[model samples]
Target: MKKRSHISILSAVLVASVALTGCAGGNSSAGGNNASGGSSTPPAQTQPSTSGSSGGTAAPANGGVIKIATQTPLSGNQSSLGDAIKTGAEYALNKRKEEFKALGFDIQLFPQDDQADPKIGVSNAEMLISDPDVYGVVGHLNSGVAIPSSVKYEEGKLVMVSPANTAVKLTEEGKKTVHRICARDDAQGPKAAMYAKNTLGVKTAFIIHDKTAYGQGLGDQVKMQFEKDGVQLLGYEGITQGEKDYSAVLNQVTAKNPDIIFFGGLYPEGGILIKQAREKGYKGYFMGGDGLDSSDMIKIAGPAVEGVVFTSVAGDVTQTEEGKKWADEYKKTTNKPLETYSVYGYDSMNVILNGVLEAIKANGGNKPTREQVLDSVHKTKDFQGQFTKVTFDDKGDNTNADVFIYKYDKEQSNFVGKAQ
Candidate 1:
């Protein structure tokens, strides 16, 4: 990787770097007007990054600077999960900074706030792509954002390792730069349907989606599978995001009086819907996908959030001894609640850093190009991380991807084991 050294270019890089401060260290620097992101992206390396990590003084950088970015919703209603993803990626980078330093490189994190919007995500992708120091990116909780943002990443030859994009269309596009550690909606939706029909013994259902790529796509999958299982489908409808009142949709759903209500959206709306549904006197089972995995739902819906079941690509880390230790340290370090995608974010970044490390080794202990890192990441096999065992298939989907079921009770999203 060649870095620009011209005086003007270096000055511009420094100014833009100052303007674009990604979230790290509980806010060491201020961020911009909107979304989780940095400003203009430059290919050149600047003075030592001010990520505000607690690590010691960074080692000398003889091999230029290498940056790994995280693109997630960091400053919105969904920031609960999105910030965790950023923090997890930051933690992974801090742990391996010394290793990269030993290899004559200084590592830094560039987290972007997608704001759960495709247009903003695409704009952030362009900024990330313009920067030459960035090689690998880990992020994108929403599959809609990931799909379009990935097109930009491919244009720049930047490899993106996503922690929580579950839509099937993401990897089916034949783009070499996009990859995700989580399972797809095709798997997640059907698994959720099976659980609803077989385990919960539900025969009739009503579906409500948030009218986005992730929510609608997952809802369609569940509807298809539910029909196959001979379950009665009372209603399948869409709802707008960012709206407080859902009385119109609630009236339609309550009229159906189905055995279960399935929502294919995030926690903010999921909480409001179920909270209002209960108040509307619709006493039926409630289920959803991973978008409801955040603890914020409990806060949003209060007692109404209990008994909610969701399927997630991430599993409970505290079930293992090492995972428990990591979770404890994470809480103590960041003072943030441990969301499910946090471990996935950590694992995804490690996977990217592993690829960067290999690219360096292959480059004879020097900086490697983004193409080299992309190729290295595509060849990952049986690489274990904090949570999942990852192995990317030819299409960039993880072969070891598995879905886990969770139940919310007593103000916790308790792991109900893997979805079989």
Candidate 2:
């Protein structure tokens, strides 16, 4: 896959690179302001990231430079999200650069491109683990990519703060080294299932998967939940990735006259399926997870995406005080629109910086070792971030964070947040 030098050109290959490599050498760097310490004047309208690691016994009052390694697809199929995640993360990192310096510390992110493949994701995790300068890591946009890659970080004793990975298994077993800034697929699956059964009042639902781990896992969860809740399971099927025609599956699905259809897959294929289903006159509501939450899905599915429902984390940050500020600066800096996971990227980076700054303070204005940084992250509590009030549960899931249901309004060319 061809790697675009600018972050504005979004693609899955770039995201794949992110899923696989951490801090590996990449396309030319995009340079920007890197001054450290608090500035007398805050940029107009934008409050710098208001994040602090509260109640961590490991962090002290003194501070110094903390290194955070971040991995994302900087060059492949999922680059749209990878680029958005990077842009938001960088914005937060820059805004708070001065604050950390005042506390006696500086922060830097060693970004790697993973290409969004699971194998590459694992490789990226190993690379970050090998870097003694790296304190903690953030990334792997796809749950399929995160599931295996996270194991490496767990063994390395380096905490992995995921900005977008939603697979339940990543944290459900109580992996202390893993923390997710978003809601899990299990929760989202049930949320969507409930919406289908109650809101849409669907009696029969057709479920399908793209055969990827993320695709199959969420599909199975929603399928089982729907059946348990007394909804008829019309048919369940799996489709091969990158295939051109979905008519075979859609044909069977249409024959079932299901009240709704659920696809557990990313936007690329999900969009195509929605388009195909519409062409076949299968008019029931089509639904998906965060994987289907993208502007491009509308283009791919055309008018078919209209009324399509999907779930997301952090809602729309542009609607909140802190969210609006970050959104404006992100647009200003990257000269590009923010996507679904941008706020998550911003929050995840803040989480890492909070721990890093605290660790440095505890160390008396000296650079913190990687293990010290990890300890700081584990000890973090009640840290407030721009998008959500963050406090990880015993399972490493963020507590009290809100998840949103979104409907694609094709005429408006955007996702309209819906009440669940």
Candidate 3:
């Protein structure tokens, strides 16, 4: 991929302003003439007397730290997705360490492995909240894991910004501390359904879910949309995840001879289901949601993954110049290419870090409380980043994000094309 640089003068100005204005006390204000029409003197400004300073002379405050935790599956079938998110977030933090330090604090990342299980996710959430320095989170890749874990964060008044969780209820109930950079399943499901009917020209479709909260919820949304579109629904079934043999269910689905098969589950089971479906002589098109996005899907299903399609809440960031530069740098640093949710991870981390910076500025370089950071995040509007312009809605979801459809190319062993 080609790499290019796009400079942001606004970011440079913001950083300079924060560093220069850090030493000013909270009560400092611009002076104005009094009612007597006499000259009013401005308050004396304190500046960091560091060598890096362009002007002013006061030492910046020290001894404060902000720790952000990542709760995601680092081991197991879904490790690819989790690892991608971790890499993206860590990259963002490392890239902005100096800028954050100049604001009188150090940024630290504490990643916990959720193993894509709700129980484990809750345990990880507890561990994260136990640390007083931990004020923000950047994970819980699976909606099933995120839903249960967010309750813990909400109780602690800690903010969590999700990069991949898309269940509607995660944002629907108005959880103040919960926010996501990705579009909801409610948005993605209808888009996928419409593509299946109008774009793929599929007359009948069968829906299957892994029975997890993420899977079942997405499948139900897709089913609802498909029904509303007046397409023939062959069947809607739920299967237990981590089961090796899906031949029994495949046989039942094959009997219907549906024009399309949509699986609402992670790559592990989705790959296995696709492999088994092809093995059973089912030749119809296979479709899925973001859960089927990882390279592991192709590795699991091999040649059987040809012509499969899926919906992702994120577009191909590498298509843009700034995104390409980021992707190239990410590959050089981690020796791994960016995955579907990596940009979401980068954007989510940026949102959190920006909020922290804003909170610190609001407090006149003083260490901000967790509640202050959460409030800053809630008030974000038109915050531009590499992926998109982020503005949180009343429900804490990104108001401007969109969904994209991608198809797997068997010849290249990768997904290509961004269809909106």
Output the number of the lDDT-best candidate.
1
lDDT tens digits, residue span 324-362, model 2:
776787787757677867877877877776676555445
Q: Candidate 1 deviates by what RMSD? A: 9.2
* Runs of candidate 3 exceeding 4 Å displacement: 1-61, 411-420
Best-first order by TM-score: 1, 3, 2
For model 3, residues 325-397, the per-residue Cα lDDT tens digits are 8788878876766787777777788788778766765765566788999998888787766776778998888
Lowest-lDDT window of 10 residues in candidate 2?
Answer: 28-37
- What are the clash counts of all predictions, listed in order? 4, 38, 2
Clashing residue pairs in candidate 1 are 36-112, 36-113, 37-113, 43-132
Clashes of 2: 38
TM-score: which is higher, 2 or 3?
Answer: 3
Q: What overall lDDT goes with each candidate model? A: 0.79, 0.67, 0.74
The TM-score, computed over Cα atoms with residue i paired to residue i, of candidate 2 is 0.81
* Regions of candidate 2 where Cα sits further than 4 Å from its true position: 1-66, 99-106, 411-420
